[model samples]
Target: MVMEFPLLEGLSPVERREFIAACTPRRFRRRDIVCHEGDPGDCVHLITGGRLVVRVTTPLGHTATLTILGPGDMFGEQALLSPDARRTATIVAVTDATTLTLNRSQLERLRLQHPQVERFLTTSLAAQVRRLSASVLEALYLPVETRVLRRLAHLARVYADGAGTPALINLTQEDLASMAGTTRATANKVLRELEDQGVVRLSRGAVTVLDPAWLATRAR
Candidate 1:
């Protein structure tokens, strides 16, 4: 079956098939580093299964979680734009994950053969910018609790396994704290409160969202 990628939404069926044919499949185990920040940009990866986190480290050795991505999401697209580009963030697999990667040479050939390829890249980058902008705004104005709730809500949606199955977020308090831009202690406190309220069930290195709808409502 042809896996539908959000980044390839604009491409025609033929174009998508051609693009997929050019890609090479790669897999990583949970907690494996897919790519590191400052690594040479070689290819773009489209997630086929499981989840991954994009993170960046500062000069002071502080790291922040930018986002968690699931099936259909694409990353490392900047490599398609410039040959001199380096990876801007490190990507680590949150679960055993599979991706289809297209190297720069393949991308160049695709762009020449399919005009929609360029459009897809442009759209993908624009969407990322908008998402990052919203994240920045939330950090600047939203309260810590609200930010934490929002992150949980996002994780619930992204890591949802299936209907009638629990939405389990496989991340530690430290990882969640980084995503919410707060301290680990603050994130733990908020999660404990939610657990007390029957909104979530906290366990070792994971959180089970019991009331995802409530979290989504309060996240706003």
Candidate 2:
């Protein structure tokens, strides 16, 4: 898994080995605050195992789930390029999580040693900007229900271990509502209708999609 990251794609076997050796392993329990928003971006993290929930808490203490991250994913990269930049969001462990963490000083040293790594970071950051731009446009224009399903479908692609429906999402309806940018009552009503259509099943704090393929059709 260490060698599987996109950021390491340009590295040779020896380079990849050396790069992995430089990383420090860190672990967190569920709900642990991996990094808080507004903190200085000290390092970049690669998720080696388990799930992470990325979010932002507003001044009013409203938490909005930005995205769910899983194994093979990377975050905290914006810091590598801009060390003094404030963290854009808060990262919490949704499940027991393990990550390979590399601090900015180490990254700078590597950037000087490995030109390919620097190039990869530049390219990856550009791609991220494009993606975020599109997401912002979607959030501005998509209907409330469509936004919710779109988020669910995206989460399934990232975190689902099996094919098709009953994709387990370990998030409360409040979390879903926050991600969808809608009120809890509206999210509940929409989810109930989806449940009636056999698209989703609501449990205590989890949601199970019975037909993600069908859900995707409607999400579009």
Candidate 3:
């Protein structure tokens, strides 16, 4: 999991080992609520296994999926960087998951010993901003089918299992709708069209991408 993280990329072998040794490993079961929105940000989590869904709910109970994070991704950094920061989103385990954590106390030590962590936080925060900006643009002008297809392609590219398993996105129609900024019924209709075109297959609580090439074209 540390292999691809830019923060650790510049470290020497000895330094990398020492940095990893400082982390505390934590595990969560499937369906676990790893952290709740508005909770005190006490730890930064680096994902080592499984997947997580970042979600937010408004006061009126309207929920949306902000993003789906897979292994090698990290979260809670924003909280760790700012004093008195509360979690901006709730994170739930999509499968049994493992993350290495650094509490605020330990982070202080890391700050002094390994300054590269600051670069990681800054880079990650910037990427999040760019993604949110693109999301706003998509919401403003993209049509429903185009948005749905694009969301699927994005997930497949980011979260595809490198193992021999199918490059399928294991999310429900409702979750897809939430991520695509569309209604569930509209998502269903568009998915059925894609299904007819042999682009995807709909199963219980999941949608399997059949032709990513074609789906990518629709996204364009």
The candidate scoring highest on TM-score is: 1
Error of 1 at 45 (Å): 0.7
Worst 10 residues of 3 by lDDT: 157-166
Q: TM-scores, in order shown?
A: 0.92, 0.87, 0.87
Model 2 reaches what TM-score against the true structure? 0.87
Candidate 3 lDDT at 178 equals 91
Clashing pairs in 1: none
lDDT of 1 at 200: 96
Number of backbone clashes in candidate 3: 0
What is the per-residue lDDT of model 1 for residues 1-220, given as tens digits with 9 covering 90 to 100?
2545766767788988998998999999999999999999999998999899999997789888877998888898889888998999999998899999998899889888887778878887998899889988998999999999998999998988768577988889998998899999999999999999999999999999999889999999
Residue 184 displacement in candidate 1 (angstroms): 1.6
- The model with the greatest lDDT is 1
Q: Candidate 1 — what's its lDDT?
A: 0.89
